[model samples]
Target: MTTKSIPDILRQSLESHMAEADLRDDDELKELLGKLNTLSGKVAAAKAQVMARRSDKKR
Candidate 1:
């Protein structure tokens, strides 16, 4: 299987549903929101790691 980022997965899922004229239930939306929260944390962690590496290289 190919690896896809969380945002890409989310976008593709939503786009497919949109094309099919399907409605999302509250529970399904909630799960997507949870995924978004997880993505946010991952982004923050990556930013911190990059900053730390840059700081180290500057020293």
Candidate 2:
């Protein structure tokens, strides 16, 4: 089984909402997606830092 990251799950949920939404606005959707992408990058960076710290402690 494959694990899905938090951001991926959130993005999927947001896209699903957009698909089912009647009041679709292009600019709003784009902005939301941009924010999600930024958050995803931050999460990735944090995870990497945590992993690096763990590796250092193991040495």
Candidate 3:
């Protein structure tokens, strides 16, 4: 992955950690975790698009 993807990579790590956390009644953290998960999906899609573009350039 490139440097541009670093932040998303970090986000993914954070999302994972948060998911593993025991936030029973923390609505704010719960909402944040959901948002992070959604954002992570977008980041992954963006990364895939970037990789595809790179491959196309090679061809």
Candidate 4:
């Protein structure tokens, strides 16, 4: 069996959320996209930290 990492799981969930929000009206979609963007940035930052830590461990 194969296991997916936390970051991969989070990325998938974020993509799904964004896809669903895309079907809404313009105003509502804009608001949702803004929030999703903020969340995605934060998640990317956190994922970077995790990757850095993993690299450090390998050194």
Number of the top candidate by lDDT?
Answer: 2
lDDT of 2 by residue, 2-56 (tens): 4666887888888888788943758988888888889988988888898899999
Find the number of clashing residue pairs for candidate 4: 0
RMSD (Å) per prediction: 5.2, 2.5, 4.4, 5.5
Over 1-59, each residue of candidate 1 has an lDDT whose tens digit, in order, gives 43566765775787678668685656877688678768867876787798899999999
What's each prediction's TM-score?
0.58, 0.74, 0.60, 0.54
Candidate 1: 10-residue stretch with minimal lDDT: 1-10
* Model 4 regions lying over 4 Å from their true place: 1-24
TM-score (C-alpha, index-matched) for candidate 2: 0.74
Model 3 lDDT per residue over 1-59, tens place: 34645445655666677678733436876576677668767887988998999999999
Clashing pairs in 2: none
Candidate 4 lDDT over residue span 22-45, tens digit each: 453468656655676677677778
Best by TM-score: 2
Candidate 4: worst-modelled 10 consecutive residues by lDDT: 1-10
**After superposition, candidate 1 runs with Cα above 4 Å error:** 1-25
